[model samples]
Target: MQNQWLVAYTSPKTEKKIYGRLLELDIDAFLPLQKVTRQWSDRKKVVEVPLFPNYLFVKITQQERWKVLSQRGVIKFLSHGGVPCSVPENQVRAIKDLICEQEVEIYGSSSLCKGERVVIVKGPLMGFEGFLTEKKGKMRLVVRLSSISQSISIEICESHVEKIYG
Candidate 1:
């Protein structure tokens, strides 16, 4: 079977640990990390934390699924109707690209601003769809995939996107 990107649910606060275990087993995995400041009694410290809590992405074939599940921290594959669902390559790539962006923001579905649907007409993320939200005179494209329950906002040129009607 061909290799596909699958989402793996892990134990609480075990995303980084599971990512490491997958790597040791020669499995390709991704754990998106973002920088945030944490407050303490004495001082505040900046740290890199998992962008998606308790979730990790892994690239593996059908034959390799069991190997990943057998790992200590992994709970199970995210499945629908008793079958593992594969994430589209474009969506996965978009997430990776978002992580590398300097002017990027991540938000849960509840907080996304309302706007017209749009697609990137040009640039590396061409064809990505999401609600367009503007803040402080800066235009951004917010991409939300309901299946993932997470949204990403990336700064884009106003001319590079066009409104799309449903």
Candidate 2:
């Protein structure tokens, strides 16, 4: 079977551990991390945290599924109905690229309102399509990963996007 990208739902707070184990097994895995500032009573510090809590991506063939499941802390692959759902490669690449840029925000799929579908006409994320939303009075282009029900939003100029009409 050809290798495909799959989302793994892991135990709470175990993403980093499972990612390491997957690496040791020579399995390809991706855990998107973001640097955030945390304030303590005494001081403030920056740390890298998982972009999607309790989730990570793995590239594997059908035969390697068992090897991934055998890892501790991994619950199971994200599935719809009874079959595993695979994420599109471009969506994965969009997430990877977006995270590297500043002023990016992550949102749960539940909070987003349905808006006009648009494609970025200009900018580093050109050709990326997502819903346009106004949140807190800022224009945001939201790229959603439907399989995981999560979205990555970034501020964009109105002129940078062109609405898609059916």
Q: Candidate 2, 3: how far from true, in Å?
A: 0.4
Candidate no. 2 TM-score: 0.79
Task: List the candidate 2 regions with Cα displacement exceeding 4 Å.
Answer: 103-117, 123-125, 133-138, 157-159, 164-166
120 in model 2: Cα distance from truth in Å? Answer: 2.1
Can you give the lDDT of residue 112 in candidate 1? 35
Model 1 stretches astray by more than 4 angstroms = 104-114, 133-140, 146-149, 154-160
- What tens digits encode model 1's per-residue C-alpha lDDT throughout 114-140? 487877776556787878777775557
Quality of model 2 by C-alpha lDDT: 0.81
Cα RMSD to the true fold for all candidates:
5.0, 5.3
